[model samples]
Target: MTRFSGFRVLKEALTGHNGWAPLWRNPAPKPAYDFVIIGGGGHGLATAYTLAKTFGQANVAVLEKGWIGGGNVGRNTTIIRSNYLLPGNQPFYELSMKLWENLEQDTNFNSMVSQRGIINLIHSDAQRDAYRRRGNAMMLSGAGARLLDVDQLRQMVPFLNYDNARFPIRGALMQSRAGTARHDGVAWGYARGADSRGVDIIQNCEVTGFRVEGGKVQGVETTRGFIGAGKVGVAVAGHSSQVMAKAGLRLPIESHALQAFVSEGLKPTIPGVITFGAGHFYVSQSDKGGLVFGGDIDGYNSYAQRGNLPVVEDVAEGGMALMPMIGRARLLRSWGGIVDMSMDGSPIIDRTPIDGLYFNGGWNYGGFKATPAAGHVFAHLLATDTPHETATAFRFDRFNRGYVIDEKGVGATPNLH
Candidate 1:
């Protein structure tokens, strides 16, 4: 691994920039390992990185069906924040925020973590109070938050439709430390970090079935081969059901397609991440001047990574309602990623009924933001066989115990979540 720094950049520039090495290796999987992570996306790669770097687990491998960064890890809008109102979600996300803050230094890779800020606009008085409460919850969790009045919001984002006849923007819940990171860079960084610590990152290696004997997972059958492992961790988002079914375990998760859009490059418009108070639309300006945005999931169960027109039109309406000026901007391209919408909208990171199998999925729309903490906590569980303190509420048996962490209060309906 080549260490990247200003001196290296200068040296490379002087030497025709040919001294750079690949960020991560394309390693072949071993026949057996201490641990195997079934996915190569951000969460899986981060899990491998944490297991090797943090937990001192050297015999680890990350098996990805496709290439790295080909999943939701690179498909998200790249917003990172911790402004939840639920006890189960607030602290976990706050931990992720702190991890994001120092991720570049920790990984020795430039993930392009920009802590610009994020503002969730408040529309009605009730919404204002709700945002205030949410902001208070964020503060209580040691995540920064502030309540900004309409005037303050106007000063920050004057392009918004402040006084619309329907759904007026009264205020906003602001998180100063919240922002975005480069999606693909995050995956590459984690992959590199994990590989440097002797974790094999095997791409194009699909897990076909679980090798369970006597009710405990011995390993997994993959396209590459039947790789043996002491423990197997499943972090395949959206495909949780299909993957778990191979092991005779069913999850309380539904797959839904969530679309994200990027507009034609424009001037520096969106100051930071901003969400409409009345709708699910959220927009942020990328470093390359493109306005990246997204909205609610497609409101239907789907395994496809493409969405329908109704969602596009609905998201456009939300965007226009928030900032009418963007109506003139042309949409450059759009894509969708399948999300594992859990019954209660919160993620699950817990040990399964099977002895050597662990589960981590049902992230809904929060997967990208929760990558670091999810990986750390999931790795903690895998290495120590105990749940992280902040993630104690994300139990697999919570639904059966009638203790669902319904963060959005949308009840048991996965589509609504």
Candidate 2:
């Protein structure tokens, strides 16, 4: 592959733009590979890239049922932050934020990562106190946080409904380095990087069943053919349970559809991402001038990629409450992506009971932001057969051991999380 550079781009532009080539090669899957990863989303592709580049494991294959970035990787609001509170999650997510800071340089692709900052609005005295504690936790974790007063918030975002009759915006918890990134660009960059490292990314190859024998997995039965593998890792997002069921493993996870919406193009209004603490709504202005936002999940188990209208109404209500001016902006489009809501509102990345089979799922709507670190740690576990330092708490046995990392304090409620 030719290295992409500004000079090359200028040369191609002057030469009638005919010097460009495909970012990645289209290669067929071999009969066997050293490692086989199911799913072609951001995490899976990142895992493949890390496995090859960091661990020196190039004989890998990533099997995607659909095209790359067709899943949650592309179907998110494109927010990235690590303002977590729990030790189990804070360090892991902080690592992801660090990786995100250097993602474009590492992948040699412009992911459009914008550290424009984010704010979680506080609506009441109690909420302000909670946010203060959360901000302290974030700062302690080295993820940078600040508790902004009402006057400070006014100076930052004067357009918010500060004087609402109810749920009035009092203040906010600010993460100056938290921001957003281009979702599709991230997936494409990782896929290209992995492909360049000789990892076969096979699209339209769905895994039908796992080839297991005597408590060990040998390979997988797929739509194309039976592909043998020395090790197998599962990273299917919302379909985690269904995919793992084929391997006879049940997970403490629920599949729910999370809806996201975009507004028609407008002038740059939102300076950065903002979340309504009184509600589940979060919004950010995209590079194209459209307002990208989303709210709570559909509140039910579903494998569908589309969402219902009630969520649309609920999200609209929250957005209107946060910034009434958005009501006048015409709604352009909306879509849904299935999320693997873990029982304890956290993710799980560990080896299954079956030897040679690993699992990485239950991201609970945080999948996109956690892509790079998820891939790096999962690759570390897969390559070394041990948990990574930052990810030791994301083990599969945590739920059984009552070590749940309930960041939202929602007890065993996937929908609430």
Candidate 3:
């Protein structure tokens, strides 16, 4: 792999910029590998990178059904934060935030990590108390937080409708370190890093079935042919249930479509990521001058990457309720990504019933923010055969064991989560 530097850029510039090579190799799958990751998205590529770079795994392969960066890794609204009140989620996400801080240097690829901060608006006294508790939890986990009153919030984001007729803004929970990253850049960087470490990234190769014998996973059957592996890790996001079903496993997950939108280019107005307390609306300004925003997932089970009209209207209503000024901005485009909503609204990363077969899914709305740590912990688990300390609570049997990490206290309802 070529080491990228300012000198390299200058040299390439002098030579008409023709000496640059591909970021990663598109390799064909080998007959066997020591480890096989079943998805090529951010989490899968990050897992492969960590396995090779940190765990010293030499023989590894990442098999993707389509081209890389063509999934949720690129479809998300790009917000990254660790402002959780739950023990199972806060520390893990903080680890990811730390990783995001160093990702560009570590991978030698620019991921455009912008820590412009995020504010969760508070609408009433009860909401203020809840945000205070959540802020305290964030502080305890070494993540920064601040409680800002209505005056302070108004100074920071004066465009918001503070004196709305229905839900007036009272305060906010601010996290100075929480922000967003370039989604596709994240996927490409991890893929390049993993490929440089001799990890085979085989695209256009779909896993058709698991090659299990006598309750132990031997490998997987793919469209390219049978590729053997000592252990198999499944991280295929929203398609978790369908992929696992090929191995006779039923996961406690449902697939739902989460829609995101971008508005026409405008002058920089939004200072940072901001979310409404009374609704699911969140908005931020992209580097390209577009207003990037999104809200709740479509309330229906869907394998398709498109949402219905009801969710579109609901999201627009939420935005209008928060910032009436946005009513004038024209929407540029909108799209959806299938999310794997777990029963308890948290993620699951654990060993399955089949020996040597690991599972990582049930991310709900937290997948993008959790990518780096998810990769690190999942790699640690696959490398050492033990769960990482921060990820110990994300177990497969937690549901049946009655130890659900109901982060939102929404019970087992997938849509509500």
Q: Every model's Cα RMSD, please?
A: 0.8, 0.8, 0.8
Clash count for each candidate, listed in order shown: 0, 0, 0
Cα error, candidate 3, residue 109 (Å) = 0.8
lDDT per residue for candidate 3 within 193-273, as digits (tens), equals: 999999999999999999889999999999999999999999989899999999998988999999999999999999989
Q: Write the per-residue lDDT of candidate 2 for residues 1-417, one digit (tens) a residue.
A: 677778989999899999888888878889999999999999999999999999999999999998988999989999999998899999999999999999999998999999999999988888888888888888888998989989998888889998878888888899999999999999999999999999999999999999999888999999999999999999998999999999988999999999999999999989999998567799999999999999999999998889999989988998988899998999899999999999989999999999999999999989999999999999999999999999999998998799999989989889999
What order do you get sorting by lDDT, best first? 2, 3, 1
lDDT of 1: 0.92
Give the backbone clash total of model 2. Answer: 0
Which predicted model would earn the best lDDT?
2
TM-score of each: 0.99, 0.99, 0.99
Against the unseen true structure, what C-alpha lDDT does each candidate score?
0.92, 0.93, 0.93
Which residue pairs clash within candidate 3? none
In terms of lDDT, model 3 sits at: 0.93
Give the per-residue Cα lDDT of candidate 1 at 19: 88
